[model samples]
Target: MLGTLHAWQAVERGHDVVQLEREPEARGASVRNFGLVWVGGRAPGVELRTALRARRLWERIGERVPALGFRANGSLTVARTEAELAVAAEAAEAAEAGTERGYRLLDAAETKKLNPALQGDFRGALWCERDAAVEPRTAQPALREELAKTGRYAWRPGREVCHLTGTGVVDDRGERHDGDLVLFCTGAWTGGLVRELAGEPPVRKVRLQMAQTEPLAEKLTTSVADGDSFRYYPAYRGEALDALEKSQPQTETARAHRMQLLLVQRLDGSLTIGDTHEYDEPFAFDVTEDPYDHLESVAGALLGHPLPRIRRRWAGVYAQTTDPGRIVHRARVAGNAWLVTGPGGRGMTCAPAIAEDTAEELDL
Candidate 1:
């Protein structure tokens, strides 16, 4: 997604572009995520600002590419306990809550009124109206189709860049593709050329497990999140959260996997849900049923019924900068080449803005 968005930005700037893809199709976290344009959980400062700008960019780009499936349906982070509700209140009461984050604290009744699909128990919810969604699985093809209409975009899939030239890059085919500038938007693939050029960056790979369910019969009016999300997002960090943590401990399974439930409905009526964080390297080669079982239990309790049969299950790895403050690890690898990676989960939410910044920085 980062690479595709960078291509989109370059093409928009009237520069002819040739995008080389390692795989015939993207099969990374870019396609495997929840497809959330999640603005609610971002940390304050640069991260939040980048998310806001990307939201605007997504909205504008969605207008031109309907297949992106962008929607402003917003999200509801359900509070199942009084402790969770207190945390929600704190976030909603923050000074920038209304203007910047579009936060609202809603009672159980109001929460159901907004998203009737959440028919189960909950005290109240934290509503973030700035949050949105898009069709992650198809976004790249849609964007590329639009870029192709400009007659300046060339997409070459199944091509791995083997070497970087001062002018451009050399593909595995030994074909020298020359250009004025080269931007390497490598995701989690940090070995080979990446290591040769910029040895061991200040970024680490994070693995996660996720799944999608069969088509839901009823409309999921908005995206959804479990109160456990409060424990994960930086936005909810406060004394209230501390109390909640002390009072309501996570289940052993959840704590072991570092789990959180983020549910988004796909255009096909299927619900996309996930996920569990795995930070240590050499992540499990297989998925575990314990985390999925926990997720299903919570989701069932929230909806007052069982979730649809899970039709798909998978795991993905994304690069996250070790620095808590930086959005990504972008640096000059050569006189005319740059390496941009490690936006973490923020890649989808902040790609457009990130690419725009790179364009401006390199004067592309």
Candidate 2:
């Protein structure tokens, strides 16, 4: 969305941008998502303005591009367990600290009023009244076309990045394409590239599994989530910081042990739910139709509806790092080349703004 939305921004700045991806179509972690452009679970003093701006950009894109499942109807996060409830309350306190952003706590009754399908008993939830989501599978292709329509940008697909140069990207087949500014935007394929470029942006690949259920005929709006979901988002770990750290220690076993259920009812009425974490060093496109059974068990306990049947399931990997929320560093190997990754699960929430940040970082 960022490349297409702001390619003009760079073009207008006299920067020649060349967009490249290894897939035949726009497919990757960025495309396969819950398509939730979220900010509610994110903490205070981080990316509020950026997300707000991205919200604005998404709205504008909906005008010209395919209808992104962009629902400004807001989001609700419930808390069933005591641990979950406590975290929600603490998050509200923290969100309120950043008075400029649009967020508040909703009692269980109020939350149910917003999303009847979100039938759960809890203390309450942190509601980001301005947050929204889009159907990524559709939005990504629309974005590709949107960018291609503009002669200012050249987008090449089915191209693999062999290495990064000061000027542009050289594909695996010994093809070099130059651009005024080059941004390495591959999702999880970045770890090796960053290493090869020697920028060593302190990134790794985290794989998550998600599933889609059969469509429900009724409308289920208001992006529904839970406090346990907040545990995964590093932003909301305030007093729950201990729980977050202890819940998912830095270990392969911890990763296998930890999973967060983020269930959102898409516009089509089918629910998109997921996910568990496992970071693999050299990432592979390892997809599993059946995710660990316990993820579904936890999800079943959290949701208003039981997952009767799963229509689709797949694994997605995105760049993650402890260094920062995101990275747009100049390659240590080649200053002209840049490494852009580490979106974590916030790709849908933060991609547009991060893309804008990419342009800003390069003065594109």
Candidate of highest TM-score = 1
In model 2, what are the clashing residue pairs, if there are any? none
Give the poorly placed runs of model 2, Cα more than 4 Å off.
1-9, 12-16, 95-98, 120-123, 163-176, 191-194, 240-256, 280-292, 298-303, 325-335
For 1-364, candidate 1 gives per-residue lDDT tens digits of 9999999999999999999999999999999998899999988889999999999999999999999999999999999999999999999998788898999999999999999989998899999999999999999999999999999999999999998887899999999888998988989998999899999989999999999999988799889999899999998999999999999999999999999999999999999999999999778899999999999999988898999999999999999999998899999988888899999989999999999999998888
**Total clashing pairs in model 2:** 0
Best by lDDT: 1
CA lDDT of each prediction against the hidden true structure: 0.94, 0.65
Model 2 error, position 232 (Å): 2.6
- Native-vs-model 2 lDDT? 0.65
* TM-score versus the correct structure, for each prediction: 0.99, 0.82
Query: What is the TM-score of candidate 1?
Result: 0.99
Can you write out model 2's per-residue Cα lDDT over 1-364, one digit (the tens) per residue?
Answer: 4344445456646566677777777667776678887766554455556667777877776777655656677777767655666666676676353454466777778877776665645667667677777887787766666666667668777877877666777897788998656666656664466566654566667777778888755456677675557767655767675774565343342245456667677767887887777765554566553354654655555455466577888877777655663332233246676556666777677777776776776666
User: What pairs collide in candidate 1?
Assistant: none
